[model samples]
Target: MRKRPAEPPVRREPEAPEGCLTVAIRIPVRIVVLVLVVPVRMLWDALVVAGRFLNDALLRPLGRALLWLGRAVFVWPFVALWRWVVVPVGKALGWLGHVLVVVPLVWLYRYVLTPVGHAIAWVARGAGAALGWIAGGVGAALGWVYAALLTPVGYAVMWVLKGLGAVLAALGIGVWTALAWLVKYLVVVPAVWLYTWVLAPVGRAIGWCAKGLVWLVSMAVTGIGTALYWIARILLVLPALAVWRWILTPVGRVLAVIGRELWDALGHAWRVAGHISLAVGRFLGTLFRWIFVEPVRWVYRSVLTPVGHVVRDAVWRPAAEAARSVGRATRQALAAARESVRQARADFRRMLFGEPRRPQPVDRREPSGRETRTLGSSTTALTKD
Candidate 1:
């Protein structure tokens, strides 16, 4: 590339006056501030004024009205209720509860519960004492029983056991000595002599004789047993089999046939009797229905029920009403009499015990208006009842 021509010397512009530049910058800033901040401040002021106006004109009055309404409708009424009704009722209830429940409970605990607890404790102590005494007596009785009976029995038993032990020991020693002597003298010597001299020959002869005799006897017995077996088989077994097969079998079959016939006859008779009984029962049921049930139903429908309705509607109802009226009148009269008696009694009591005071003229005028009104109302209530 060709060497770039030397760049022209850059010409810098002369700097503006600092005051003018500052003034120009401040003018724009002030214009921008005036454009933005002035309107914003005015809007803020207007909003504050509007807010104040709304607070004063709308919100304040609304709040005051709502507060007044709340006070009037809810708060004042609630306060009044709490002060006038709730407090007094609460106090009255508290007093009544104290009188009815707390006082009674305290009295019960003091007079009844405490005394009952003490009595129970005393009874428990008595029972414990009695049980202890019983235990002591039982122990004493056991000790006495042991001393009176068991100790002597134990000693006697011990002595008897000792005597028995001594006797048994003596018997054991005698038996041992006798056994030793007998073994030495009788058993060994006899066994040796018999083996040497007598046993061999005698055993041979006895064996030979016994063998012959056993053979003869076996032969004889075998013949006798075989003969007797055949005889018994022929005489008893064959006859028994024949009798069972022919005579007893026929007889049993005849008896079975007769029994079956008798059973069938009895069953037939039973079935006939059952049928007859069912027929008789049906006849009786029909007769009862005709005689008793129909007549009773007819009577009840035609006579008894109508009569009962008449009595209930005409006689009983009127009687009951009359009786009620009479009872009410009687009750009212009795109440009036009781009131008069009470009044008289009160008057007498007053005369007898009332405080000494200046005598006042008795107005003999017919009862006062209030008294007449009360009497009239009472009489009206009683008459309505």
Candidate 2:
């Protein structure tokens, strides 16, 4: 015997120990949930059964009929139109486009445009080479002119400007030195003395007064803010925090546990109700089969089948054979009458038109009557020489 594979162990979380409060809450919650869920579950199962019955008995057949009707009314006509009319028309149009437009465009490109493009390219290359040679000659002339004529003139201009710049720079240095000495005594020295002795002492004294005033104002503001902070914390924040921590948290936890237990119990009850509904349905089906179906089946087998066989053997076979005999006699009489009518019509035509000329047979084969079949030169299907 083959060894069965060992099943993997399922991992489960360790359950927390329940207190009296949790136990007290869970039991009532579960009972209430079960009571509430049972009727709803049973009703749900009943609806499921009713829906399945409707689907099988009515809706499925109706949908299939509608689907067939839709195919006949909508889909089949369009498919036939597409297959018989649209497809052929589209293929004809595609062939016409290929002949009228695509073929002409391809011919123009290959035979006309290709040669023209090559000729234009060759002309452009010649023009470009000519222009490049002319540009090179003009560039060489400009280089010679710049080196021979512009170089000496540019050097002479630069030398003259440099000498002038040195003279101007010497004069500028002397004027700058005189201006600096005059500015030191007339403007810079008095400004420095006034700032160091007069402005510095006044600015320092004003800054010290502003600092003292700011410190006094800040100290008053800080004392008031500190007092308000302590008062608000004691009156509002601390009470709200205490209520949240000590009262509301415990109440919320209990409510949460109750809700969780209620949800679990509802699920469990629904499952149990489903099993009960299934059992009840099976029992009812068995009872119905015994009460009605078996009796009908027995009647069909024991009573109806024998009576039908007797009727078929005693009455139906003789009636059917008589009907067939009558039909065969009728068909034979009609056939003889039709043959007499055709013979009369043929005799009348012969009297009117005289004897008709017989048609001569014409051979339609690859080799003419005068040609002989030779194995080495055969073109027929049997020998593809």
Candidate 3:
């Protein structure tokens, strides 16, 4: 079996169809004129040129006219506003000018309002007179009605009074009899009943109170006697007791010294413990300050100070720097793309001819051998053997 060439071996253009390619069409002019290429840079260059041309040819004149029109339309209006409205308003507000303006307003007011006020006041006075007459008539009618109604009411009242007087006299007799009976029942009989039924217990209670008072008096007398006896005993024994106590002064001194020493030592010990506790509390407070507050202070200095500075620089300054760098890089990339395109054009020219100045003649010759050469790189050619 024949050996196949290795994969990815150099490729070659297919040979012109067996003998049918004896005649060839001239395609260089077509390729040069009718070819479509992705010339982004060329299009961009054309746009730039067109833009510059448009700015010079069209936009500049348009901008100048627009500026002049704008000056005419807006600038004059802006300039005139202070003079036309603001100055007029300000002048009208001045005292002398305001007084002059007020003259017309006052004249208008007098011409329009004086007659209306007089007419309204006349109508009001007429309405008041009518109302006064109606009020007087109503008053006379009401007075007559009141006098007529009073006679019947007075008669009814007199009749009622006569009946009431007779009934009252009868009731007076009964009331006197009832009052006399009630007085007898309430004062004489009930007093007798209370005296018979309740006074004995009251008297006994009063007697008991008297006995209690006597017993209390007796107890007070005994207490007073005891107090007097104690006072007399103290008066009688105080000197002897003093003498006896004086005799034991030396023994009391020793015992007092011992007791005072014990008390002083206990008091000193308590004071020392209290002082130590206070000092410990103070030291703990200071230690807490050292451990927590000092560290926080140090952390503020070490971290937050630098972090805040960095953040300020990053957020404010570095962002500006990055924007500048990106703009510069974009400009450089555009320049680099232009340079690459120029180099590619130069290379294509070199391949089409030999050099820019001296072009080589093209030959439409058929190659003699079965092997063909193809370009693999700009500097190298590959052959399929």
The candidate that achieves the highest lDDT relative to the unseen native structure: 2
- Local accuracy of candidate 3 as per-residue lDDT tens digits, 113-133: 887888999999999999999
Give the TM-scores of the predictions, in the order they appear: 0.39, 0.69, 0.27
Q: Higher-lDDT candidate among 1 and 3?
A: 1
Better model by lDDT, 1 or 2? Answer: 2
Q: Tell me how far the alpha carbon of residue 229 in candidate 3 is from the true structure, in angstroms, after superposition.
A: 12
lDDT to native, each model: 0.82, 0.92, 0.76
For residues 1-385, write the lDDT of model 2, one tens digit per residue: 9999999999999998988887787778777777787778878888999999999999999999999999999999999999999999999999999999999999999999999999999999999999999999999999999999999999999999999999999999999999999999999999999999999999999999999999999999999999999999999999999999999999999888878887787888788777877888799999999999999999999999999999999999999999999999999999999999999999999999988999997855567768887656666787764
| Best by the TM-score measure | 2
Per-structure clash totals for the candidates: 0, 0, 0
Model 1, range 1-385, lDDT digits (tens) per residue? 7898899999999995654434444544444444444444545555776799899999999999999998999989899999999999999999999999999999999999999999999999999999999999999999999999999999999999999999999999999999999898978988998898977998899999999999999999999999999999999999999999999998897676556545554555455555655565588779999999999999999999999999999999999999999999999999999999999998998999995579987855345556654434433444532
Worst 10 residues of 1 by lDDT: 376-385
Where in model 3 is the C-alpha error above 4 Å? 1-121, 196-201, 204-211, 214-218, 221-385
- Model 2 segments more than 4 A misplaced: 1-7, 11-14, 20-35, 68-87, 106-144, 178-218, 312-385
* Full ranking by TM-score: 2, 1, 3
Q: Which ten residues in a row have the lowest lDDT in candidate 2?
A: 376-385
